[model samples]
Target chain A: MRLNGNRSFSSFSFLALASLLALFLFFVTLLLSVFLYVGPRELASSLLSEEILFSIRLSLITATMATAACLLVAVPAAYALSRFNFRGKGLVDVLLYLPIGMPPVALGAALLIFFGTPMGGIFSARFVFEVPGIILAQFAVISALATKIMKSTFDGIDPEYESVARTLGCSRFQAFYKVALPLAKGGLITAVAISWIRALGEFGATVMLAGATRMKTETLPVAIFLNLETADVVKMSAAVLILAGVGLTALILIHKLGKRWPAV
Target chain B: MIRVENLSMRLGNFALTDVNLRVQRGEHSIILGPIGSGKTTLLKCIAGIYRPDSGRIEMDGEDVTELPPERRNIGYVPQDYRLFPHLTVSENISFGLRVRRSGNLEDRTRAMLDLVGLSDLSRQCIKCLSEGQKQLVALARALAIQPKVLLLDEPFTRLDSTAKVRLRRELRRIHEQTGVTIIHVTHDFEGSLNSRNRVAIMNDGRLVQDLSEIKKYLDEKLGYIPIDLRAGG
Candidate 1:
């Protein structure tokens, strides 16, 4: 029986290791296949093209703006959800989860409909089918995810620290900024990186709300769609590589910082 | 001075019902109870961390029932010390002063470090300190605000035997030196019985005995005579 148990344990470990390696190889091969369609010189020229350059710049600016707006709203919302018990708290929690549960295209369609309404029509001139629409869509989709991450971070911290700070003469806001915010540094970084990455790669919503215009509203994902439409696989592959490279660098940076801080 | 009048609170399955007690100015008092006897809950209520469903808490003739914890002018040292993990020893001690923007921040922080005898470890990180050192930091941090009353919830629960004895001595010395009213909560009977401080015993969320001398309460309530009292007799 002991020999049988040892054999079963080894089989389980083998199965898990094999599954991990299989998934690793699958992604590595999928990413490497993009290089087969374009040579180095073509890839460099495609990347330096005016339209692609504009797409890259637009994606960076919109993703940064969306991430900043998301944090401004998410930090306080998550703190309230983590710390307080109020009327309609359950309803508020469900509403915050709505965007995460909905498909990106459906969320985009909803935003399109809202823009047609009289209330949303007020801002339609500034946002609908414009560059700012990309940022608004990304913020809508990633804010829920950012809030969830921040809420988990706050939940891991003990409420006693705030209580002790209160007794130490810190007002509620002071305690939050001085003690709670500093302790949440690792989670804040995680939220910002994940949300920014998600915003950069946003496609279905960006195309739906921002209309995939050539240079005016074209982000990187929109650029990929346009290139694919014209069957320009070389430019498409270059754009894919650029997006993948940026996301990989961000993930690596987050990993390095996570090791250094190691989260409280 | 602290007075709790008809204080009652119910949290989930635990409740503190109609608990009343008083600690006089400059007096050291101990709230002795078993675990889950609402000792910490009572201390939190006194510190304004938890609002009782019904009660009036008066500190030095001021009824501060509706006040928030920050406005209460009380120093609280929770169980586990709760030193801000991100800050160093001196920073933890000076947190109250910094938040209030009190003048002479450096001199005050240094004085607190000296009072706790932790000046040498002032720059040390909170994670590097032993349990005893963390407790002292927590104590110094609390006392730095010069609160009218100090509420300590299970200050010695995590200490080893030697640390417990040493902390008890340190607490007594600090109490004498500052003349600050202190209400310490603990479950250790033998550990709390040594001091001449007033003892308030609690059971099932009620104060069974309030503001009585330690020896008199032990003899009358628990029928346990002290060795010194027997020798005197």
Candidate 2:
């Protein structure tokens, strides 16, 4: 109808048009909020706060670390899941996906309960409530997402590439590192950006497991939440703006890199 | 040498039983069969992609039934060419060399590209390639590793008639030049078995015929089959 045709569009056409319109409205709201609720003047004062600065820096550092860890762990996990046909493979795959479906607060609380009780009695002296706890919480969230995305990417790749590499005298590991990994660079980078952004935006998990201490455990989301309850809407909005900017930048980078992916 | 003795396996909704064969070093053998004849399955077993339940597969007189595919040192060119879509033609050609940590990768890749007449398209992305070009790249990539054995599954299905003739001639030349053992799998028996030293005819998972008695077999058996063997058909 919108394309000026007299006849009604097909279901697929209608579905696509609906999604496009929904996405357009979503971006419109985001832009409006950034301009009206969290304008430049509100951001100026927010940038001066020690708590906000500390939270921002901490979030960036921990999220980056989490991204690295997740990539290292998920690449092999996803590759195995995609390529092999072993016993209980389905069960292992589901377990890897467990944390993704759970609410972040519930996931964090469960981890806290498990790690804080008997498990913590063993290693709590070193892990929970510290910077390690924040990293662990971020890792918990990021790794699950990275594994899911990376698995789909690995699935998209033809297994014959690895098989061919193997015949060429490359060990399985070498084939993965040299051939499969290079081919999957686009999906892997996309996964990294997504996981990084998600880790950077994590709130309930970091807050529940790590605690929102002034400078010790407070993260960007925690700082934003704390500022909001205190009625410091201007500073909160500025932090929100910073979060939105980072997310937008990540999305743009993903799009650009996605376009550059080699077509073998 | 590669030997498959009494290979039998039950695949989902299909089965290959008592499959047996041998390929001497430097021999060029082509497999011919109808659809559902387990030609591809037999190749898969040799390539280590499928494990036969009861078979003794020996490569160079060593039992390789337990070996993983990556350790088999056997090059396989799958149907569809299976070129890595994320790599350029040059990168695809060099993939095997890189995987093997073989020195002189550039020289090997260059020679293979030249051999396959794909040197000019070496920098092009595989997705941009025509069907024949992609097949050429895939062939070159397989040859780059210099494996002792090469297995090609339906190698010319995607090529046009002109390209197919060229590829067949090129395959013969490469087989002679490299002295590497070659096995070709195809359902198009007439098109594939031409001039190959030996032909293995399979049907319903069994070796119905191995036409090594070339002149006699051709006159007696092939003469009766209504398949096209002429060049342009």
Candidate 3:
């Protein structure tokens, strides 16, 4: 009976391993399929086009800005969530989940509606259909993701280190920056890389708020959409490959850094 | 001098109830109790990490009930030692001094390293140290700040038998060398009890006995003398 049980377990393990390989192959094939539609020469020409170049620049700049803004707010917010218990903490947690749980299209529509409100109208000119709108949209979508990542990072760290620092003549801020922040280096890197990649790939919110204007507020994802609308599969494939390459590079870097500095 | 008067605190299901204790200057006092007896909580209250609901803590005869941990001038060494993983031994020892911007950084760090006999491991990473070595490094770090009182929670709990015996000796030497007031809490009666030290016994979040009262309490409760107490007696 025990030998039969062991044999069944072996079979189950093989099935699980086969499923993992199948999923891995599916993603690899899906990513590589873009190559079938566009030749290398055509891809190169499409990538070097003024519109594509503009979208690449715009995407990098806006994603960097959005990721920075997300981290600036997320780090402290995550620390508060991880460390302190305050009144309405449950409500605060639910509010943070709204962005992550809601569809990006709905969030974008909400922003569009808010921009039409009297109070939001004052700043609508600065954000709506503007370059800043792309940044704001990306930040709105990914800040919660950044916060969630950082909160888990801070959670893995013991609070006693900070307590010890506080008793060692460090003010609260000093303790956080000196001890807790250093320990959270790996998590912070993961948050930044993931948020930047997500912001780079953002489509629904950016298109809704910023409008897919050619060469004006065009990001990589937006450019891909516009290319596909005109049936320019070559240019769309080029954009897809670029996005995949950058995201892959970033993931590899994060993996390397994670090895070097494992989280506390 | 450190005094906790009428201290009471409730956290989750564990509560410290009306706990009162005092440790005079230049003395080492051990708060002995079993696990979950709220001994660490009481130490935390005195360290100002947790505010007691109804008590006032006094240091040097001044009330410090409202003071934050940073302002309390205490040294806290928790059970795990909590050495900063990214730091070296010297860096960990000098952390308090550097944060406070105290002068003579090198001199103070050197003194602390020498005091703990860890001068040779100054540049060693925290991960490389043994449990006993980490304990000494923690001791050095706490003493480097010249704190008004030192609070140690289960300092020897993680050590091997050999390291524990060695650490116990090192602790006594450190206490004598610095003359800093110390409140060391542990569950090991045999390892901690010393004739020269003041000992307090706690159960159910209350201080049930001190050195003078422990003999009678043990006689009535356990109906026998503990080996350590007999040795001390």
Name the best candidate (by DockQ): 3
Candidate 1 lDDT by residue in tens digits, A1-264: 254345565776778778999999999998989887678899999999998999999999999999999999999999999999999999999999899999998899889999999999999988889989999999999999999999999999898999999999888888898888889999999999999999999988777788889899889888899999999998889889999999999999999888876667
Compared with the true structure, model 1 gives a TM-score of 0.94
Clashing pairs in 2: A263-B85, A264-B85, A264-B86
Q: What TM-score goes with each of the models?
A: 0.94, 0.88, 0.95
Q: Global CA lDDT of candidate 1, please? A: 0.90
Instruction: Mark the regions of model 3 whose C-alpha exceeds 4 Å error after superposition.
Output: A1-9, B210-212, B220-223, B226-233
Error of 1 at B146 (Å): 1.1
What C-alpha lDDT do the candidate models reach, one value each?
A: 0.90, 0.82, 0.91
lDDT of 2 by residue, A1-264 (tens): 466654767887889889999999998797677668765765787777787889889989999998898889988899989998999998999999998998888888987887868756697755578887888888888798999999999898887777777776777788788778988999888999999999999987888788877688878888788887888887777677788889999999999998998433
Task: Count backbone overlaps in model 3.
Answer: 0
Clash count for each candidate, listed in order shown:
0, 3, 0
- Residue range A220-246, candidate 3, lDDT tens digits: 999899998999999899889999999
* Candidate 2: chain B TM-score against the reference chain B: 0.89
Q: Would candidate 2 be rated incorrect, acceptable, medium or high by CAPRI criteria?
A: medium
lDDT of 3 at B111: 97
Per-candidate DockQ vs. reference: 0.83, 0.61, 0.90
